[model samples]
Target: MMFLVITVISTFVLSNESSRIPFLNGDNFSDWKDKILLTLGCMYLDLALYVDEPPEPTVKSSIAEKSSYDKWKRSNRLSLMLIKSHISQSIRGSIPPSDKIKNYMRTIEEQFVSSNKALASTLMNKLSGMKHNNSKSVREHIIEMRDIAARLKSLGIEIF
Candidate 1:
């Protein structure tokens, strides 16, 4: 039917938008998390991130309660799928599984904290050792340096 075709097309377009987020390999969790949050926010799919899951609806439940539960369930399911999809298989294997988006995200944050320190030190060393070389244009060299600094900033190092 026309409705089913329209639904499938819309879903495809929306999913393509999420492909802008990079895979969460071990070294890129902070950047990946930032992109994930931004993408979810832009799509209005971040309800599960900010809210607890709603209680299940019963026959006696009010319409408002049923609606809230439905909305939360959809948000939770989709957000989990999006987050899991962007993580690399190697890193994904280490994560403790959880159906609850909030709990899963908390675990992910914890998993990355130690690695972030390692990443920060690696970036710091690179920044310290970088010198102006004639090999690349000044613009390119500076742009590369700035990109490193931005990545460092995302990891909580303020290099400005």
Candidate 2:
């Protein structure tokens, strides 16, 4: 058998002069060579018995397969309508009815009440005696946009 041939060859290689150079004592040379040959033979036997096959690749659905655009479009439209309704109600003297937004605003107001009050007072003073104006300053518009985005995010809404 292949095992018998490998064992004989390993024994012969270990018995060679170069292999015996590591063991200066002749008394333990045979024992050391036997241990080395046994270890090498075991390693060869293990390698010969090993089963080698490539691992199978995991399959995953493509984006289009996983996401149906039609369903998403319908849901997105409903969400936009809900946001618009909330904004319209807020603009028409109706404080947003959503408890989530109210709670979020309460937390923000508690944290930044002094700063917010000062900012609001300054804005009111600026607009107090002004004629009808058609233009918005870039800074004011940017703040408004940021506030809108923050409100949306606080409501657990995914913008993207």
Candidate 2 residue-wise lDDT, 59-79, digit = tens: 464555434433333333432
Top candidate (TM-score): 1
**Over the stretch 24-140, how does candidate 1's per-residue lDDT look in tens digits?**
989988779888998887766789999988899999999999999998888899899999999989888999999989999999999889989998999999999999879999999
- What residue pairs are clashing in model 2? none
Q: Which residue segments of model 2 deviate by more than 4 Å? A: 1-67, 89-160
Q: Once superposed on the true structure, which residue ranges of model 1 sit more than 4 Å away at CA?
A: 1-13, 132-141
Counting clashing residue pairs in each candidate, in order, gives 0, 0
In model 1, how large is the Cα lDDT of residue 144?
Answer: 91
- For each candidate, the alpha-carbon lDDT, in order, equals 0.89, 0.39
lDDT of predicted model 1:
0.89
